[model samples]
Target: MDPAGGCPHAVNARLRTRGAVAPVVLPGEVEGAVVLGHEALKDFLAHPDVAKDPRHFTALHEGRIAEGWPLRTFATVRGMTTADGADHRRLRSLVSRAFTTRRVAELRPDVEALTDRLLDGLEGAAAAGRGVADLRRHFAMPLPMGVIGELLGVDAEYRDRLHHLSSRVVATDLGPEEVLAANRELPALLGTIAAAKAAHPGDDLIGALIAAREEDGDRLAPEELIGTLVLMIVAGHETTLNLITNAVRALCAHRDQLALVRDGRAGWADVVEETLRWDAPVSYFPFRYPVRDLTVGGAVVRRGTPVLAGYSAAGRDPAAHGPDADRFDVTRSARPEAARHLSLGHGAHYCLGAPLARLEATVALERLFARFPELDIAVPEHALAPHAGFVGNSVRDLPVRLHP
Candidate 1:
């Protein structure tokens, strides 16, 4: 947990305890260190020259290569979010059309229906003398998985396997050999799904992607197709899962806010937005390296220095969010204001599933609170297990008692 130890993203706990923004400096006495905050970090993310390709950082690349991780395969290159220039534009445009606000709006009915069904299952379990249930397993995890799986045409039977594959792919602390093993295994599994979709066309994202590939004739590469599918599944499930669990926990801790949500005085949508700001599901974007030498907050970031934008820190920036930035205010009117938080990221690589994530969270919260108005945490917050070095900060299990 030492700030100066392994992860550069780790801030000094002592500095945080002092109630101030932690400064991130370059090694040695650099003239200007990156002063990360809402405004400064926003400028950094908005800067056209602050790129995302990891190849910009030769040292990081060499380190990974020395560790036996694949440098140019699905681990890095094939992923659409990592691409730049014409490639990034082309892929993003194609994918954006599918995730348009209109398209996501159409999926809202299905999201609500799925939420209702999950709530029914939870109610049944509660009635059967199972006084408490892990909301993480019963609701948070499955709701997003089902929605995303339907979008991608992944079979219900294989959804569990896909979830397992996603966990392996995004693991940060895994050794080089372990990461490589995941890289090898993911494609084979996805290849099977791709072949199935190719043989049997269906009304799903994967089918649409396959059709697009066929019509375009080499425009959409096989690796790109599979990687996009994997990204959608992983991105869709992991973030929203945490959003639901975190929102529920936040509500439990604040009974007044829960009452507001239950009585419809405050919309559940506000709760969802506030929860995202309070404790974001995806704490940081994957490592982004500068393509050219750049200055952020007066710090000279050489071309090829790795930078991880701190979304968690940015969410709590006092200037952007006011002095009470740490307070979770569901009634806060500025929730939708632009530059609120980098949870969905900024610029071209911004999350493609933002609309769907919002829809799922809204629907999940509406149904959950309506069903169990007296829901309470089964264990103290500190007792819960935390997911470590993962894309989302998820509770390993969220046990809650549902009072009928």
Candidate 2:
């Protein structure tokens, strides 16, 4: 996938002609590899020989991915994202138990309360100023951070630092050194917290993860324990922040769709789902190394080759959806499982935090529009610049007018 996840014109058109799996030369850490179509992506992910984290990178597998920072801090620990087979199952089970569907459902009131508080502040700021505020900072950013922070039992004070660090880790606009610095800070803080939790486990998810045990009385490795906690925070909030921001931008930019939701022709769920297809929060999944020579979409991805999961590519794929796939239409029939494909990922590596992300975005967006029905973007659509990142799909700031 191109670094510019939202700029889908020529990249999409060119790739569409190359069939389901196209040879692509992506810059930065990614080099030439195959890009999967919607179906191909699902197939690639679920393939028996495919590994979630790239094993081709020797340093990464040992949790020592080279960086300006020390190897101790990289998120390459063999946790859920990187593990395979039994290791993957064990890690996923522990982490998933901490974020059960029951727990996600229990978060509704807290998400609602957090959304309301953020909106109150935004409304006041808009009232005081010229009715303009960077909704990205004031609303989109804080709501998910707040919700995930509380859920993970991170202290309120660490939220700001975590957000700043996560921005560095995910944003492509930043230089390598800056990104490395962000990645460095997180594991240090999280390690200290996890050590404390291991000693005096609390009632929160982090504590639950810290105390989790396997049938033979096995415990999570020190690296996995900390990695799982940090993964939850970054993954939980980062995607949800972008989801809410993208949804608001889509609705405001396409007023006809906004009106459809307002007129009850579609609901918030429709808006969320459509935006997910139109502008996925996670544009590209990181390196997935094939365990052996594998044929994907007729291309032979050699064993140990770095395969990028072109999630954004799959989102608007015409074959999966329809001839009108490129167009973002709220009223289109919900793309069945096989068609829309793996925006939230699929199979064993499916995002455990997805249900919670959806809940937060739903509450945040509904409360936002319900409170300020006439909300409008303060800047021209063209002026809303996105960050220079290969994977993340959020913009810099979503400036909007409350009284507009």
Q: Which candidate leads the pack in TM-score?
A: 2
Q: Which ten residues in a row are the worst by lDDT in model 1?
A: 1-10
Clashing pairs in 1: none
Candidate 2 has an lDDT of 0.75
Candidate 1: stretches off by over 4 Å: 1-36, 60-77, 126-129, 213-218, 334-339
In order, what is each prediction's RMSD in angstroms? 4.3, 3.0
Per-residue alpha-carbon lDDT of candidate 1 for residues 1-404, written as tens digits (9 for 90 to 100)? 22122222244223344233233333222121233466766777677886656566556555533434322232264667677777777676656776889999998888888889998888776666478888888888899999888888889998888877677666555556876787777788888988999899998878888777433465678888877777787888988988999899889998888887667778888898888877778654445666777766555677765565556666766667878877778877544653467767777777888988998998898888777878888889879876645345656789889983
Instruction: Compute each candidate's TM-score over C-alphas.
Output: 0.87, 0.91
What lDDT does each candidate get? 0.70, 0.75
User: lDDT per residue, candidate 2, 71-179, as tens digits?
Assistant: 2232264578877888889888886764678988888888899899999999887877678988988899899889888877887888888887776665544555765
